[model samples]
Target: MQLSSFKSFPLNTLGRDFAVGDIHGMYSLLEKKLVAVNFNPQKDRLFSVGDLVNRGPESSRVMSFLGQPWFHAIKGNHEDIAIRSATDPDYMDLMLRIGGAWLMDKSPKEQARIRQTFTALPLAMEVQTPAGKIGLVHAECPLDSWDDMIFLLKAGKQDALHLEEKLCWSRRRFKDRDETLIQGLHALVVGHNVVEGMQIMGNTYYIETGAFLLDGEHGMTLLDLVALKPV
Candidate 1:
């Protein structure tokens, strides 16, 4: 089944909403962080900036985590690789080189299940907060305005595919240190490039603190959307 490229969620009035950076298969570490925050999945929601799989020990368990009703996510570059690698032989090498060796161990059935889940994920998501609307993309927003990106993504044409490439893989914003605030969003959250710590540039937030890194300094980052601060 074809999935829409964008999804919008109403304000989570029942409990707090949190946005987490690229998990990269570190489910255990993520669990520890969630415990520290006293996350009650019954009422709370966890939104992932994507890159939910690959690079860590538990990449195989991504489907189980994604199954949780309280967890929401967008498709990241790694997920794109997972989708393509299943059909396009050319992407397999690229996937393995980028720490997706875990996929090789999965049975054909499991791989298909994983691919289907990735294909179902939207490229962009928006969640309403008292502060305003928060936008989430796996990487940088290729366009100047959040609404424009949403419009283009909804179009889902050839140009939208190009923008999707940028959304999942481009790091130009962080590399150039672009501070241009995207219009029509209270804040834009993303993950892909690892930063030394959680950072904010203009209204965009970079929260991926390199959960895949084995170094002691880096761990999973879960940012509270309402407070716009790391938990």
Candidate 2:
């Protein structure tokens, strides 16, 4: 299936909307936290900030979550690595070295299925919330304006490829402590940067609390887009 480079979800008028940080394959931990928060799949929707697989124990279960109707996600850099490794021999070592060794155990057919799943995910997505529109990208939004980012991603040309690199892999915003907000978005949520907690710079929020890190010090973060409180 050819999915768009950008996707937009209408407001969840029926129930609540939640956005989680880089899950990194801690499927059980995520589910436990979801139950703690009383996440009702029957009504609420869960938006993932990408990095759904890798670095953690349960990466194999990623496909099950992907199949769930209520779960939505964007493409993370690890997903990019896994996709490339499936086709290009050069990327295999990189993928295995960086918490993706679990993929090696899968058969060629299973690998292909996983690759197709990640490839189908868009680089960026937005959800309409009662507060306004919230944007979700794996790492950083390259452009200052959301509209420009969407247009460039949709074009999928040479320039878009460069932007895609920044979208999936850039850390300039978090590294430089950039406080500039992207226009046309009420708030932007991103992962890929393992912040101490949910760091709010301008309107952008970094919510990945290193779920993959087994050190008791770090855990997952799940933010309510409707309420948008850091947790």
Using lDDT as the measure, which candidate wins? 1
Each candidate: RMSD: 1.8, 1.8
The CA lDDT at 121 in model 1 is 89
Give the alpha carbon lDDT tens digit for every residue of 1-231 in model 2: 234678899988788889989988898998888888788899999999899988888899866898998999999999989999876887888888878988889898888888988888988999999899999999998889988878777767415448878988999999999999899999999999998878998899999889888533347888989778854
Which portions of model 1 show Cα errors greater than 4 Å? 1-3, 214-218
Error of 1 at 120 (Å): 1.0
Candidate 1 lDDT over 58-146, as tens digits, reads: 88776688889999999999999989998788899988888888877889987887888888888899999999999999999998888
Q: TM-scores across all candidates? A: 0.94, 0.94
lDDT, candidate 1, residue 113?
78
lDDT (CA) per prediction: 0.87, 0.86
